[model samples]
Target: MKSALGKKKPLELEDNVCRRTNVFKLRGNVPNYLEESGSTAAFQPDGWGYKSHWGMAVNVYSTSITQETMSRHDIIAWVNDILALNYTKVEQLCSGAAYCQFMDMLFPGCISLKKVKFQAKLEHEYIHNFKLLQASFKRMNVDKVIPVEKLVKGRFQDNLDFIQWFKKFFDANYDGKEYDPVEARQGQDALPPPDPGEQIFNLPKKSHHANSPTAGAAKSSPASKPGSTPSRPSSAKKAAPSSSASKSDKDLETQVIQLSEQVHSLKLALEGVEKERDFYFGKLREIELLCQEHGGENNDLVNRLMEVLYASEEHVSSSLIKSMNSPSSRRSTDSPSVSDNFRFV
Candidate 1:
């Protein structure tokens, strides 16, 4: 056999600082490529080479080649089309539930979809959804940084930029699988009704005639269906709750009495304050009426009063202001400068 030792090709290894894994699995309905708004390079069959997504040598995965930019309209359309809803702005994504669904679309079963509250109306609830998204990101080991603090504040630029970055990441890894946004959410915001017992903690009644807490609870209790007789608890089972409820009701009544007394006192104080305000206002109004009766603004006394009125609220000396606004002062202010007649031409 011919000697193969010297004939062996020198071992050559390429230095790839930005190394990437050739094998990766992604499931998404969107095309697996990023492009500028109007350009469809990677999306076309000619551009779909081995390096690209769709075809066989065209290196479509070259990020440096495409100067992709997402406009507001394009981002909104992408979001609406993927989520199957109408979202006029990206700031609405503050709730974070939609982002949780995004993770689900990228990596199915990464999060419990039902836990996301689409109808969450509070800031804390929004934070909760974001926390869930963070946890999911941790589990998936995604390298992206999420600015939860800035994002939760719902700033337009912050959220828009984040969404744009996410759009690029999504396009690169998407496996071209069909995903149903509605079915993935399993009906958004399936929150249970508020318990009748919890309504007791609501803000105190603002009406003049406040009802007792027990009465309010009774009113809030769910009513029986039409023509259906309501069932009563047995005496054995009801005795404990009856005693406890009575004790609680007694405490509530005491609180109500104390609050009512405080409210009454506040109302009386307010009335006294109003009377004082009116008394001062009436005195000023009477002086104004007297000024009008004498000779309107031109009268000397009226002018002096007006001067005092126009001056700062601090006490002013009678001599500080002139008795009337002279025509000489008016002419000085209104006429052109004396230098106009003697310009250095």
Candidate 2:
């Protein structure tokens, strides 16, 4: 139950940019600061508490990750083993109250073995070069924590200039969505009254001559010489019953085929659902028998079995048939009657 951080030594180093860098390296990436030549430790980015000639102060922390890893308890035991192997110097770093406090604030209580084992390596380096570690974290400026924003990114010029540019960009692209009425009106020309129903007046009338033949011609053509027109025969109404009937029959066949397939699919689904229901019913009966035998409630047995199996009620119930056949479950169910008989005797 003890925290890994709780096991670390608590140290209040000189609060400055350098010390902050050291803390960052310890907490973040320590192996990155390791020296290749066994000379002064070098952190590629300067803020990470690596100083030239600060021999042995820098710790190189590294760890491996696994797919299914150990719990914090297992990790703690592993860390203790690592400390024993490493001459106990690194172990000293973790044991101090200062390191403890730092870890307490830095990590959640149960850190995985990966992060701790990695930090343990750094702890080893820190112990070897404790003085360098101290200098790495030593303050160069009055400020304890470095202003990473200003330091990492070059200081920006007056923000007012940027704001001005943004305003110019906005004005150029402004769509009158948020325009002030008075200011917008000042920039606009006076509007004229709209002509009423201009669309209706301008719309061309639909031409009857264009749609109908004889009637339109009679209306539009010069009055045909009064008696010149002749009568014409009317066309017969068309019917193709045989073709239509055949087409309808084919359509009905297709629909019947589709309906049959749908019915078959539905039957399969229904069968599956029925099977599942039956399984659950069997499980419930088995649980009932178990409860009666054990002098326990059926509902309680069901709930307990569901918990033990880590399955839903339906799933557990479905498996009850198997449970009923199970010798162990049947024995438990039978044991209760014997107990009751003994009591009676």
Candidate 3:
């Protein structure tokens, strides 16, 4: 464990700010520029990328959220769909692999994904992944403190709060690039399984087959015994993924992302249209109310405006003309400028 820890350059692990201006930039909110030249790459408040991370990534309603609603399920679904992680809850993301990958997605070729574990079985493994995440955060100037202890505990509320902020930051920084979680992790999702199931396939299939007997055991119900590894050859049970299947899955995931983006755009457009519709409806309603309250004094103008408002789209001008010439139409000398109705607006 000491040797493993030694391999990674230990973090400064303390804050001692003696800047030229004597200003201390707060955590995850300040620019920790190593080079005085001011060239930075992480989620800094001044950064064009992940600038929102310093502030409230908690309020995920902004942007597309990239979803129809930024509800808990929607947030989790977005994560699972994007990362191919079967995350039923936010606590599953406590390992911080997903966030590291997110940073990698935002700034390509940063985090060493090979060192990062997708299936962190042990607490130490989770810590290792989070350390990598912290390194990336530090490198990129992402101004947020990762509450490792709380997160590693896999508490729902803690993880949910962090992930909600993460989702917002991701949406803010993501530039519509297709990120393959499977490919990113070298086709090893290390999908967070239940405690018992976690032992079955924590490592790569080949490694598990050789190191553990769970694969060759071939027993359908292996939860009864995690240590029992039968010597039976289990080549059929754990075949390497075919290139074709992998490609198809990638294509499908790509399509899903594209469709989701399109759907988000459509939703935004629909909202704009609805707002405009309501605005016009409200204006017309207001005008109608005015006409109802004072039509006796301004019969001709009200009649004309009413005819136009009630006109059918199939033949707008014809409908207005018909209403104007109709025998039942009211006649009055008072003709106010059409602008009166819209002048207040």
- lDDT score, residue 12, model 2? 31
lDDT of each: 0.57, 0.34, 0.59
What are the per-residue Cα lDDT tens digits for candidate 3 across 41-86?
3343422222332322211222343344367788788887887778
lDDT score of residue 112 within candidate 1: 74
Per-residue accuracy of model 1 over 102-136 as CA lDDT, tens digit each: 88887787777776777765555676687677666
Candidate 3, lDDT over the whole model: 0.59
* Per-residue lDDT of 19 in model 1: 27
For model 3, name the residue pairs that clash.
28-143, 28-144, 29-143, 42-140, 213-229
> Who wins the TM-score comparison?
1
Deviation in Å, model 2, residue 188 alpha carbon: 73
Task: Estimate candidate 2's RMSD in Å.
Answer: 29.9
Q: What is the TM-score of each candidate against the true structure?
A: 0.40, 0.20, 0.39
In candidate 2, what are the lDDT values of residues 147-265, reduced to their tens digit?
Answer: 21221111223212222222232222222333232232233322211222133223245653354343443465464368775334311211343455456667756866786787677
